[model samples]
Target: MPTDIAFYTNPMSRGQIARWMLEEVGQPYDMTILDYDGTMKAADYLAINPMGKVPAIVHKGKVVTEAAAICAYLADAFPDAGLAPPVDQRADYYRWLFFAAGPVEAAVSNKSLGLTVPEGRERSMGYGSYDQTVTTLEKAVSGGQWICGDQFTAADVYVGSQVDWGLTFGTIDSRPAFEAYAARLRERPAYKRQKELDGALIAQMQKSS
Candidate 1:
């Protein structure tokens, strides 16, 4: 049986990324949009996720938190989507996924905040430096049209979201490779549909405000 999913979110947050993943998987979900007055921190939601974060999902009576985790879970649950690779490809899948979540996120966050690694600790930094991370990502995307290869997998959803958000906020440089990669991702029907839905929701929210 397919599990019923409850997606707790705030559209303005990273929850948008999870929304995109859900659309990619073509899963039906019930959404509860949280407001800024600490509503997400309420006792009930906190029971679902103590961290009071958006992008949490309750499926089959089990709660899954964190954006990346939710994306990965949905891919597994909906095998028909083929967002994930086979067991033999699991190693590469986990590698690139975590690489996007950890180092890529850290670099983007730090860059947005104007933070820099200490001069002596540069070598010890997980992401090395923003420029180095961007260069590494450029090479990865430059190797093929997508992150993993010619195929578009869930890895692209995760990593592509990072690259898309980074470019949108100017946190990451817009090299030609990155630009081309983002263009290809945007051309996907799933991505376009999700963006349109999100845009309408945003407009409605603004009108109500």
Candidate 2:
């Protein structure tokens, strides 16, 4: 039997986020692993994602790109998975999801590259300042067991990835709240399964290289 979902990604990239989301959705998807310097930039994969990036998904013939978008898309596509909050009650869910994808992502990436906002230019940046963004993020996660409270929706998967990866890579501050939330996410079976699958793929790629 063929599945309608096709996942294009490299284990070493942010594709891990989508993989985790896929695992959480508990749906079968055929995955295509692309190499950064080669096939990813080739014309074939380019059609799926003009940017030639990993972590693009083709679901039922429609294309979805970007890790955060993919996470949210999967949640809605598979409502039975219960990964999204009720439609009318999704304010917080959408808030933190885009927050991580936008501000949090920008702040961390800029800091990693040693790029600062420069004096008086904080207002020019979407994240304002790295400190401000992380501080706000800390409060967001500290609000409840999940970003939207009690419900561990797709928001957790996206926001949690930012916190989890930030802690592991020293990209984001390891505040107590962040550490606690990440620890909880790590215990989820879906998170563990995603790590295991990606870990094995990473090892194989290393050995073959």
Cα lDDT of model 1 by residue, 118-184, tens digit? 8778788899988888888777678787766777888888888988888888888988999999999
Task: Identify the runs in model 1 with alpha carbons over 4 angstroms from their true place.
Answer: 1-3
Worst 10 residues of 1 by lDDT: 1-10
For model 2, residues 1-209, the per-residue Cα lDDT tens digits are 67999999999999999999999999999999999999999998999999999899999999999999999999999999999999899999999999999999999999999999999999999999999999999999999899988989999999999999999999998799999999999999999999999999999999999
TM-score of each: 0.94, 0.99
Output the lDDT of residue 42, model 1: 92
**How big is the positional error of residue 29 in model 2, measured in Å on the Cα after superposition?**
0.5
Consecutive 10-residue window with the lowest summed lDDT within model 2: 144-153
Task: Report per-prediction Cα RMSD to one decimal.
Answer: 1.9, 0.6
Task: Look at candidate 2 and give me any clashing residue pairs.
Answer: none
Clash number for each model: 0, 0
